[model samples]
Target: MPPSQELRRKAVNFKKGFKLKLEPEEIRKLEAVVEKATDQFTVEVAEKLRGLRVALNDVANSQIGADQAMQAIRSLSLEIKGMGGMFKYPLLTAFAKSLNDFTKDMGVPTPIQLDIIAAQIDALYVVMGNRIQGSGSKIEMQLLGALEEAARKYRHH
Candidate 1:
């Protein structure tokens, strides 16, 4: 003989869904705030660049804690990559992404690789220092292409 068991099913309660609509004024206000934040992006990125530079210097000099410095470079480059486009600086984003990608799997970089890294860092500085928004000029594009080529050539060598 088998005993019968009762099965209870509970209905899931989902809160009512409402459409999220922002009024024109609210949208304008939000845009204004974003604009202000964008203006502050330079200062924040500059600080990060300084940190990157310090790490690069450490690596270049073969200083103690070079691994930690490499990690810092990777982390800062990633952060810069993430923030650049949000502030209307796609050029900066491109450079940061290049730097981040180059350093992603690197340990202690070779001297030539270090040179490539320095060039990328310098490109980032050029972008930010000139406030070059969007995709930048033809020459900048050429520079980016050259850096990418150099990175690829020296990556596995």
Candidate 2:
């Protein structure tokens, strides 16, 4: 089976067995924890962005093997993607996933492809720095659409 299909199947199976109801108090506590974590994440957002920049630099400079660089980019992308929504910046998640998919689909990228990746990363940095919120606002959607276009355009090359 394709990896995507297999992953979907596993996700379905996992969700099927994951039925838990949180009590009101427990829900409140969990929300509070999430809020606190989000706040802390905001404080360190620049550091996280720097880490991503470093990963991209390593890939661009060929300082690391392609496979290792890809892994690092994938790891950072997943981390940002997974946490973005939790912190109320779902656009960041979307952009990060675009970045992750681009890296995965492009294999060892060409210079042009690297430029695309860097563009996405820069866009992400803007979103994180500004704390853009929700799934997307009008301006955010426009920005995301542009990023998506760039990804699509380069993905086929």
Candidate 3:
């Protein structure tokens, strides 16, 4: 057998409790399943992002109770942070993390902070609506940079 095959065989036969390695055919089958799941997830994420965009706008405009808005944003941001990578949208994850950090324990954000939040929400909307995946494209880079600058201006400490 070739060296690679020999190595794979050895790995499979190792006495220790290592996980079983899939044969080449099995690996291909598993990859197809993963691809299908990823595609479905991508489709689902668009709707979720649209909902988040609406919620974020509502939170921004709410004048009665900032706490309720904060709570809603917290939930949405956390969900985006957790799910963005699963759907192959790391830029969404990054934006969500930033928004999450900014909103942590923030009762009512200052006007400047609200501006930063609006920028983040808009960026996320653009990315999700356009179906931009991974780390985002060139235009996304510009958008993220501007949003980050706005965020930095309001970051306490």
- Candidate 3 structure, TM-score to reference: 0.70
For model 2, the local distance difference test gives 0.80
lDDT of 2 by residue, 21-127 (tens): 76788788878888888767876666667877887888888844866776778878878888888878888889999888887755677888889889888988888
Residue lDDT tens for model 3, 53-148: 666666678767667766777777888888887667899888888788777767777777777777777777777778788898787887777777
TM-score of 1: 0.82
- RMSD (CA, Å), each prediction: 6.9, 7.8, 7.6
Each candidate: how many clashes? Answer: 0, 0, 0
Report the error of model 2 at residue 62, Å: 2.4
Per-residue lDDT value at 103 in model 1: 90
* Model 1 Cα lDDT, one tens digit per residue, 48-117: 9999999999999976788999999999999999999888898899999999999999989988989999
Cα misplacement distance, residue 63 of candidate 1 (Å): 4.8
Best prediction by TM-score: 1
Task: State each model's CA lDDT, in order.
Answer: 0.89, 0.80, 0.74
2 or 3, which is superior by TM-score?
2
* Residue 53 in candidate 2, Cα distance off native in Å: 0.8
- TM per candidate: 0.82, 0.77, 0.70
What is the model-wide C-alpha lDDT for candidate 3? 0.74
Off by over 4 Å in 1: 1-29
